[model samples]
Target: MQIPEYQLFVHPSDRNELRKNIWQDDPITAKLTIGKKKYAIDLAYRGSHIRDLRKKSYRVTFSKPSMFRGAKEVHWNAEFKDPSLLRNKLSFDFFEEIGCLSPKARFISLKMNGKNEGLYLELESVDEYFLGNRKLPNGAIFYAVDGDANFSLMSDLDNKVKESLLVGYEKKYGSEQDEVHLQELIFMINTLPQEQFETEIVKYINVEQYLRWLAGVVFTQNFDGFVHNYALYRNGETGLFEMIPWDYDATWGRDVDGEIMEEDYLRIQGFNTLTARILAIKTFRTHYKNLLEDILTNKFTVDYLKPKIQELHDLIRPYMQQDPYVKENLNVFDHEPAFICTYIEARGNYIRSQLDVLE
Candidate 1:
């Protein structure tokens, strides 16, 4: 089936206002239509650099969650840095294939004021609704909005607060004002002795599930995800934290700025404070190694992923050609999929070789 279309209409004055405050979180009213259904939405410019770009990313919050596609909030990613326009979609697909809670994504054509904005990746917001969709219990979800929330108990570079190490995380679910639970988790991670870390960590986190999510991040080579670009949720039933991957446009052998990354760009150890501690435990390290091996053998190899990449590339090729933002350079769109295939093969090999030396 062809990708769906989004028609957004904003009054000239409101649009101008949004344009003026694109760097800020100010949202303006807009009318959004999909198929024959219409919605009233508060549209705000999203992302850091992309907000200043011609084809901008946006955060669309519907008046009600059920208003459109049963989602209260959604993001339209410009994918400006990624020429292939497949990094986020492919990365999330891999995460789902490996059984992680990642946001659902759709490739859609976005038009504003009847002008073609470009091909955008529509993503589901990770909120209570997302947890419900996964049949997961509603709990606290925090977004690592800045670089400092790298799961470390140490104060941020700015030295925010020692007691509340939740400096960079923005609470998306549960009580925004409460930092006690989050701080406790951090305290355990930082202060717990190495001998008791494994036992204590599992009490506050789904250890195996977290290892799987960590594997996804490492395999995808998403450097940003180790510290930022993830949502941490406390499961209501288990009272343990789990990770949800987000903003994967910087993955699959690409750095956050979309530059080509080295095949071994991320080390298996010392990526972050939490991960370093986890890997320090022999049993946990062995478990993580086994997971990595399983993925490389079964799912992450070129033989398994090449066809999938080809299928997605073929499906989106025509739309990529029509996208005005992508018109500046056609070569990258055409060749990047092949580059990805090569990257997958090389990355898998590199990880396999480095596993023994990681400790």
Candidate 2:
């Protein structure tokens, strides 16, 4: 299959500026050409460890932050560390199937100054545009950028009282009032009495959505997802927060460095203070237990995912053969479908065994 091509034309000075600003998120002016159309844009190198890779990732924003096919910005991830190159997209698709808000993604080919950058997964940015497209009411979005976003009163790293309730979240949309609302929710999660917390927590959060997201994380076993790889959105209409998944490349039987991770590495309860509180309530725990069982019986099984895995793997095989970073490890990439299938079978059985713990 032929993937869409994006041509980036960065002036020499802008290219130098972008290269020098490796860790900075500052974007430099550029021109992007896509299918006979040209758009002025601000482009920046994205990701932490990925910035050091030969095949790098990028964040592209329209110059005016205007919509381009329902997206104001796009994340072009090299997905270099993932041998399958399908984990991120697969995880996103899985979340959507299990009834959670997730970013949409597709494969693309990129060229910078006429240099081939090979295959990339183009991910949609979760912002105002994202909500508008879904016809959902406008909401505030905060990205959980670090371990401090574990919804706890104490710091995960230092184990000390947090200086503020909103330590690790980056406010991407909405005003200071929205930030205050988030702080209030986090405070309630940590402070309220058990019965009051169980009854009132639903007022501050969309509990069903949270449980669905929790189940997705539990199934995929995205180690970073519980704390730092999600978006907290405060719904304008409901006056409650909802969950969205992000940055899921390090999942599906692999660790961050692409090493093998056992299927049962993560637990069904998942980690984080908010999840613990939600599960502490008998009703919520029963709902979550049912959600996990339903998903395990239907969605997370090897039979259900094997064809999907093969389809994605086969679709990317041609591109994988030409990817600049995988000349020697092509075999590893080719075998990833079977590897993922094995993982699904093992992971499903593991979760099935652990479901009663939710009782």
Best by TM-score: 2
lDDT of 2 by residue, 1-359 (tens): 56888898999988888788688898999998889878899888888788988787999898753668788899999998898999999999999999999999999978889987788999999898889989999989999989999999999989999999989999999999999999999999999999698789989999999999999998899988989889988999999999999999999999999999999999888999999888989999999999988998889888898888888888878877876777567899888999998888898889988887988
Tell me which residue pairs clash in candidate 2.
none
Tell me the spans in candidate 1 whose CA falls farther than 4 Å from its real position: 64-66, 156-163, 176-178
For model 2, the run of ten residues with the poorest summed lDDT: 63-72
Score residue 70 of candidate 1 by CA lDDT. Answer: 63
lDDT of 1: 0.85
Query: Per-residue lDDT tens digits of candidate 1, residues 177-215?
Result: 336788788878888998889788899778888889999
Clashes of 2: 0
Query: What value does the lDDT take at residue 31 in candidate 1?
Result: 91
What local lDDT score does residue 335 receive in model 1, on the 0 to 100 scale? 88
TM-score to true structure, per model: 0.96, 0.97
